[model samples]
Target chain A: MTENRDSIAEIDLLAYADGRLAGDPVRRAAVERHLARDREAARLVADIEAQNAQIRALYDRVLDAPIPERHRDALWGNAERGGGAWMRLAASVALFALAAAGGAAVGYHARDGIDVPSSLIERAATITPAEAGDATFALASTGRERVAGETVNLSFAMPDLSAFGYRLVARGHPDPGAPNLVRFLYRGVEGKEVSLFMRPRMDPGEERVSTRTVGDVAVSYWSAGPVAVAMRTDDPQMDGIAVAKVLKHAVDFARVSVPGPLDEAAPLDGTGAQMAVEAEAGTMLTDIHAGPSQLQ
Target chain B: MNDDVKWMVERQIPHLRRYALALTRNLDQADDLVQDTLERALKKRHLWRRTGSLRSWLFRILYRTYVDNRRRWRPERMAADPALIDAFASQPPDQEHRVEYTNIAHALDQLPDEQREIVLLTAVEGMAYDEIADVLSIPIGTVRSRLSRGREALRRFRSHTEGAAPLRRVK
Candidate 1:
């Protein structure tokens, strides 16, 4: 609005400050000349640029943070789970389930006294091989436990922890009442426990993979589509995030749909206690055994 | 579904994530937005027209998904997410200026959702006015005015918060 040709409007000056006026050299030059003479105007532009820098510095690194693996697996994984007529219905139900589950879990835990993380861990730790007999029908054991409305895959392939020299240890008996939570435990060379818990989420709202330490145990949790998965370990050095991602990727897409375990599919719900020792012929067995610390 | 579309969508993910981060201001929320956007785009990949810029198309989907979710989780929550802000606020010791940096996060957070979206699209993603209009399905004039008001609002916020308690980083 300034009559003087050299003077700049606030909008034009701001645009110029943001490098948005690059296509208009004449106007930009006028603003530059005005700022050159008016230290006040130059200071405004500098302040504006500084804000821009702060905003960029705050967030741009996310672009560099390795894309969380579950996200990547959703895009590229070969085994697809949720594309059925059931999936469309399950998608809405999953969302509803998520919110309902959260509310129910809070109320249920308050009333029935189900400790979410600990009970899950403790129960998994207590279940005997005979108790985990459901893993025998590896997939069926999980599939059979589904609630009437639950249609998503409830079981996941045991993550090939062989890369870290860990072997299948046991499958925990999910509380019959809260049958959604499936636990697969693995053990390292020294018998350290690493448990992967996979549950088909009814909650549509589960998004981020979060990690926390319960006592000395490190727990990492995230959701992929209809499934929510978490991996827990006592090993402090295991990048819980990376391992959680691996498990999430497996839980979401690489679920072993056809029967047949790594060695022999747990006979419909008579799954063995120590699976690594029972690993069937042709089951993958990685020779490179390293502690969780060597995951990198 | 086709390889080219797949590759292009994959490449735009970083840019989408960056812009989403600027809008959501929470890493978890931002990544979730990107993931949701990608899922939708892939599911409806057949609807994609080869005419306009792929970036614009992807951004359009992303913005729509974000708006839909925000509506579902209505009453916009611009709560101070220290987890995200502190990541950047952990910069320098120039006490006087650190105040402005802190205000920067507050200012962006406080901006109305539309203004925040318009401002970040222009400032972070460097979208042209027309491109923004295309992304948000608004006129170019609305884009220009919203952006102008957004910048002024930010400046006002910084000034108002000046000399307040020293901003601190949390983890």
Candidate 2:
């Protein structure tokens, strides 16, 4: 009889850990009462919770990655049409621009509008990369006292992804709607647009690259040293992490190439920069197994 | 396919892709698996009943597709790296948390395919036992037993590596 009760208790313990017993307050309290006396069962519950967190930490970013272009094309039938598709693409881009520009004000009007667009803008600004689109222009416009006197150039030069068949199309400075954000738009060979929103990193320690999908667009955001960037791309073919590696490698190289005036102005955040470089190298090593090189 | 079904199927793509990636751990293969699943689902759209959960139906198709092509898509599995765990462990408590966060991927990769699928569907996909049973076409009792066994395996794996003694197994 004792063994039978214990067997049922064990199952209840598993159900309790999974919140299966939540709907039944009587059973939940009973399980809680049992857990208070059972140290091993308590530890088991904690382990399950920790394991769940770890599993999510590992794979939840997949939700943020853009759906593969093949899948999107397969479903939407966009890949079937050639010339007509390009016209539609152009129209969509025009529509997006108009909506973004006009909706900038709408974000301020309604608190709920802060979700997709405004939050993207806010996040870009808050994590804005130090260097805007142009390295030279960023240095000069940032003010001589701040740039030459006290701050490292820490310019995040945009990678020339022409190697990957993407060309820079439009660059937007922080407008009234989106403050302290720099937006870079890149057009892919297949008429897909990849937009990168960048801001300065306020926290040096937060360097994990995270991806989020808002509606049809995928946003990959990470901070490296003084600058932070979020690459928002709707191009189904775009691999967010690979492109981030390219950007990180470019920024690391830029840091090495910059002249001494900026170097002496401020002490470099060696740790963050080193971590970024190491991460970039680690990713490059893994890229060997990532199948064909997107870089032609 | 009709627009409504297409829209419903499209909404479930991310969930399907996430599950596929968890199963394969290779991006290219996961995407291929997803592509195949989508194609199969489209072809069989006529059989899908409107009353059933589309998410469960889509998952069932994806799971079946993965099982059918498992051998072809199975990449070389990675063993858990103790040195990596040590590096994370040597840090402060916060870094120890990093060990917990990062090492689980390796541990998960080491789990048996059946256990890994059950664990992922439960933890990552947030599927209920009945739903999981439906998706996998297993009995509800099997779902409960598999989930318990999977969680126990994960707990033991973590506890063993961290040098902590795990509780005695009830089963």
In order, the candidates keep a fraction of the true contacts of: 0.22, 0.31
lDDT score of residue A254 within candidate 1: 33
| CA lDDT, every model vs. true structure | 0.54, 0.55
After superposition, which runs of candidate 2 have C-alpha atoms over 4 Å from their true positions?
A1-8, A79-296, B79-98, B165-171
TM-scores for every predicted model: 0.48, 0.49
Top candidate when judged by lDDT against the true structure: 2
The ten-residue window of minimal lDDT in model 2 chain A covers A99-108
Residue-level lDDT tens digits of model 1 in A1-296: 23345557777766776665543445666887888798767766765666666666556566676767656665656644332332232112110001111111110011132123454544433443444434322333434432343222233355655434344545544455454466666554333456666654333222344444343334555554344555555444344444544454343333223233432344333222221111221221121111111111
DockQ value for model 1: 0.09
TM-score of chain A of 1: 0.39
lDDT tens readout by residue for model 2, B1-171: 654346556667877887887787666788999999999988897777543456778889999999999897785563234433332222322455555655576678767888889989987776667878989999988887777777777777767776754433111
Segments of candidate 1 deviating more than 4 angstroms: A1-7, A79-296, B72-81, B88-98, B163-171
Error of 2 at A72 (Å): 1.3
